[model samples]
Target: MTAFVLVSGMFTGTHVWRETAARLTAAGAEAHTVALTGLDGPCTAPAGGIDLETHIADVLTVIDSVGTAQDREVVLVGHDYGIHPALGAADRRAERVGRVVHLDSGMPQDGVPALAAVPDRSLRARLAAAGGRADTGDVLKPPAGADEWRLWGSTAGVPDATLDRLTALAAPQPLATLLQPLSLTGAVATVPTTGVLCTRNGASIETVQMMVGFGDPALQALTDPRVTFFELPTGHWPMLSAPAELTDVLLRAAAGEGHRLVPADAAVPPAHLRPFPLDVPEALRERHGNVDLHLPDADGPRPAVLFVHGGPVPADARPTPRDWPTLTGYARLAAAGGAVGAVVDHRLHDLSDYERAAADVAAAVEAVRADPAVDADRVALWFFSGAGLITTDWLAAPPRWLRCLAATYPVLAPLPAWGLSGSRFHPARAVADAGDLPLVLTRVGLEAPEIAATVEEFLAAAEDAGADVEVVDVPHGHHAFEGVDPTDETREAVQRAMRAVLDRVGRHGAP
Candidate 1:
């Protein structure tokens, strides 16, 4: 049996951990719940008087008071606001705490407070006003109407009676707890961490990565290779809402089962890549502007493939490329082929934004290279359909890290819609600037009429320009045939192209 220290967030005590702890204890693991002072019963401290150190001490005391404190493996689990104290304790007792599970809570980074990390200004303001220590005295009640089941919505799968009990047993939390800044060094990060995301809250490892755009240290923790991410399809309080499911997740996390979630077969994509965050606006969350990494099994640094999905014209009901059946299927195929697959998202609406689209692809490349599992020196780019137009700039001035580029049914010429009238896009002109960069062009016989002339012209120009270009004629294939139909021939062609790329990079076999 394992041991777990369960910590609760604000407005609640060990009571909030009742359901989860019971389940853990039933599984033969010793579960200890820490209840901070002045949170449950009567209190003397002013609204902002209860500092974070006090809570940290509470958690530490529990850590020591438990049976044979150091006799067994221990995992400290923090939910919501409780993460602060748990973090401090983990830092102070780094050797003893084997793993820290952050359950749907924001990880306060160095020099950043929990409240300040929140991106939503209005929500931040509301939390501040509700519990501002200077204004509210020592403690603040749960936000008005927030305790009701409706506030939690459909995500809270718990019964009405459970919700009522939770609301009734809630206590006032110290404002200082929310406002306090965490003090952390490299030690806390050294402790293995797992992020248990609650799906309904629009919080996931991916969302945290997206939020990292604002330079939030808290969200940056998700990038740690030692960190594992899990998703529970419930509201913020899964302990009460979905005890059994949450319990299983907790057990698996304790057992270090996260790495198994992403299999070489690419059977099931993790939840982080599945649902789109609800908080982001549709325009900002457009399916075309996202990027994801699909890693294959690796013993060390391995060759990587950067894939650009086709479709130059944007569609209204466009699904996220990560969720698209064809794109993800291709990613799985790449994994099976023994290369780290990276799928990139870019603006497909305004043809003029091709430069920005190129940047998105570059960003994905950088992100993939950042992974220790990928070989920084060897990476290939595979462009599909109209997306091939975005790679002309890369061909013109190739980076040393890029080995080769492969295109399938590409649009090699710029259209009027691309807004390049004065400086029209032309890969034929860039062929001379390609500078020995290996290229493979796969042209389909049933290609779109609008781009046929340009493809033919570019092929002729490349032959004369002394550029090393290999052309593969898929006579029966159409634009996006692999994604749409994925005929046996198309699959074989893709496999051959990838193998050729690996052979060029000298990394063909699996490690």
Candidate 2:
């Protein structure tokens, strides 16, 4: 068995390659994920020093670097539009190119420029399926969960209606490649080839049409005696939504078995189902430009709860933290109390944008309002630790969608306490004017006997400012409400706090 060389398609980098590579490595084969040239953009090379040939050369370079020392044969896989470089690498290397697997990709044709292999991309096709009438070009937006948001600005915790609008705005792929034919004569016939198709309800009709085009007699030289064909029971992106199932199929393909028609096993069950509001779209976990913002995983509109991490955290801290409340203990509480949830992120530090952070929360709230699952009118905010102070300031002026606010172990009166000017960026004055706003404050005992008294004083201050307030105590824990899981005691405390706040805001039961 040869070392497996995996290549991701056009417009994508090695970010999504981890799962397939990991699975193959676990099965005992050396796996490598190759990054193409030009697409990665040259920061030092005067902007655009690379070309298509340079990219093909890059694939060859990866093979020579790793394949020479490992295996003579390779079970090469190409995803999306990556087939072009994969075939060219195979055609050039000749000996090292063993098996070429086109995973949900366009087939190559001889005498055609690389760009001609692209599939047909019409805004009309996408719009026809999405039930919209917009014309988008190039910037293929992620399907909206519920709003008018750019793909870069989208968070998974968005509401459904907003998602519908955003999804309708998805752009068309470049037709440059679709109009060209790929040259695969030299090494394609000698190598084993396979094609796996990804399909979904929202997928363009041309996907299957492209697959048929390659199988046509005019493309005979591109045919393979060892040609294996497969169709995935999923949309164009089975990888993202169904990684585990998709991984198994990818593994079978790499091992020369993907062409076979065996069903893949399902993904393992998640650990819990707590309910937490996740409508915020801040940068929860970010790696450079690859930020994974949160959105309410609920069906309709939620008030959209935005939670910011303390200063900045590393990207590797995944499962997004927001899921802890949404999938773990929060579910039990939400079921007992009947409240939709969400969590969101903002642009991270260094790359931080204060104006965008404020806008992101507001946009997320707007998205939550557009969702059918969440009650837009009952939107709120929950802040923890520094976030308590940050959100207090956020809610002070509050986005137009914000209806109520709740903070745990809040940082009361930061300007006066921290010696910062009101004009300074520390705390926005949203807290002071969170006018006639319904509020819930959760404080842990044992920090200071006077902390509760301080909360009472803050309540008095809020009352003076005409804000409604309710204070709840969770014993045996200090600040930040440590160990505040939804256990029986914790549940009662949360419920009591909820009932009081809802009563003040005049909201009860489901909406």
Candidate 3:
């Protein structure tokens, strides 16, 4: 028999797990819902007195009381903020834990506080400004109403009554709980782990696999056989939105039955570090701050293409995008033809960095146009990956000097859980504003579902608005196809996209 211990996240208690726990019990599993100090059940601790240690002890007490008799397996399931304490306890009692389930939460590293996981950008910024330190009397209040639930996590698929109850029963989180850094002795590393992704809450299993391909040393552990993944279609609170499904997933997870990600080949270079597919000759290059210019061999002024790389790339990613072979290859290909090529590095370290990144790209364009080697009036902008969101600005207000725009595997619209609704970055809606500006879009058949949906949405909007758009299709390519899918079709798609964009700039610029 499997004994399950449930730990709820911030601003809620075991009350939040009532439905799911009942289902688990009905399914013949022993379910014990933990009531963190100050959040649920009877609490003798004063306001702000319950730090992470208090909650860690709370979960540990429950684990101890559940007992390991009859050789029963104990599964510790942590949801959101609850993962901190759950991890804290599991780290200390790794031998006793059969499995540790990360339910809709990131793998928190040692020395990071729970505040780092809070989804509200403004709230996180405000708390960061205070150094995540609060007085003994201070506490973080939960969302005040139904509309504010998004301030925490996506409320998709959750019924209206559940949202109301959640708001009404929400507890003020102790400031200390979030402020304290999680300390791990590394014992939990050996324990079997399962990641339960809440797709509508901003992450999917595919995204996780994509990140693992980035070759980040820290994320390499996810490739371990001991780690598995399960995705829930609902939002953050699966207990309320999809209790039965959540219970089923949990049971399967405990049984060690879930999908495992294929480990990236250690012998091959990471996707980003691989050589660019095309073999174009190098161009005369110059760097100005964050931008790199690859000049055409000809002396006379020429048309230019400014390439914008995709991101939410880690701020510390080595070699940067401008130095990457893919960007440099595209730039050199443009230069080898008849035009100058330019690449710019923008600060898009987080989803909220779009506005700032857009500003950076705009600044880079002005710098590129001002160069004596390039024709200011015949410049095209080409975007890649997440940078696709930044294209909305250009699409909404195309200047006369801007000749053409190109996007490759771009995310034209924000994901549902990104909380970017009504933002200026919706290229699908903004496409209607693009009057006479030519758009060259290169789409891959094997693109991730969420990203592909955005491209389709943009295409539909473009068709509805009668926008001038040209599409180059790679029927078997994946996102970042240059490195991942190096086929004749991939090379042809790249060349075709280059020709289409450069032709609009009054030159044939494909090598």
Per-model TM values vs. the true structure: 0.49, 0.38, 0.86
Candidate 3 weakest lDDT stretch, 10 residues: 41-50
**By summed lDDT, which 10 consecutive residues of candidate 2 come out lowest?**
261-270
lDDT of 3 by residue, 240-311 (tens): 999999999999999998988766566776676688899999988999999999988786779999999997
Best by TM-score: 3
Model 3 residue 419 lDDT score: 48
1-511 in candidate 2: lDDT tens per residue? 5577777654445555666677667877777778664334222111233344555677787888774644456777777667777787888777777678776665566666544332322332343344233222222323334222221221223344533533443332223332234556566568877777654311122222222222233333333346666655453444444556666765666566633311111132121223332222322222222222233334444333333433222233344434444322332333233344445544322112333454555565565455555566666665554344456455556554465677665544331112122322332334457775667777766443223444555666666677666777777655433232434555566566656544533344343
| lDDT head-to-head 1 vs 3, winner | 3
lDDT digits (tens) for residues 403-426 of candidate 1: 888877787875422324234346
Stretches of candidate 2 exceeding 4 Å from the true structure? 41-46, 69-72, 119-185, 201-215, 219-225, 258-511
Off by over 4 Å in 3: 41-48, 130-133, 144-146, 257-265, 273-290, 316-319, 352-356, 416-436, 456-468, 471-476, 487-492, 508-511
For model 1 the local lDDT of residue 272 reads: 24
TM for candidate 1 is 0.49
| C-alpha positional error of residue 13 in candidate 2 after TM-score superposition, expressed in Å | 0.8
lDDT of each: 0.67, 0.48, 0.87
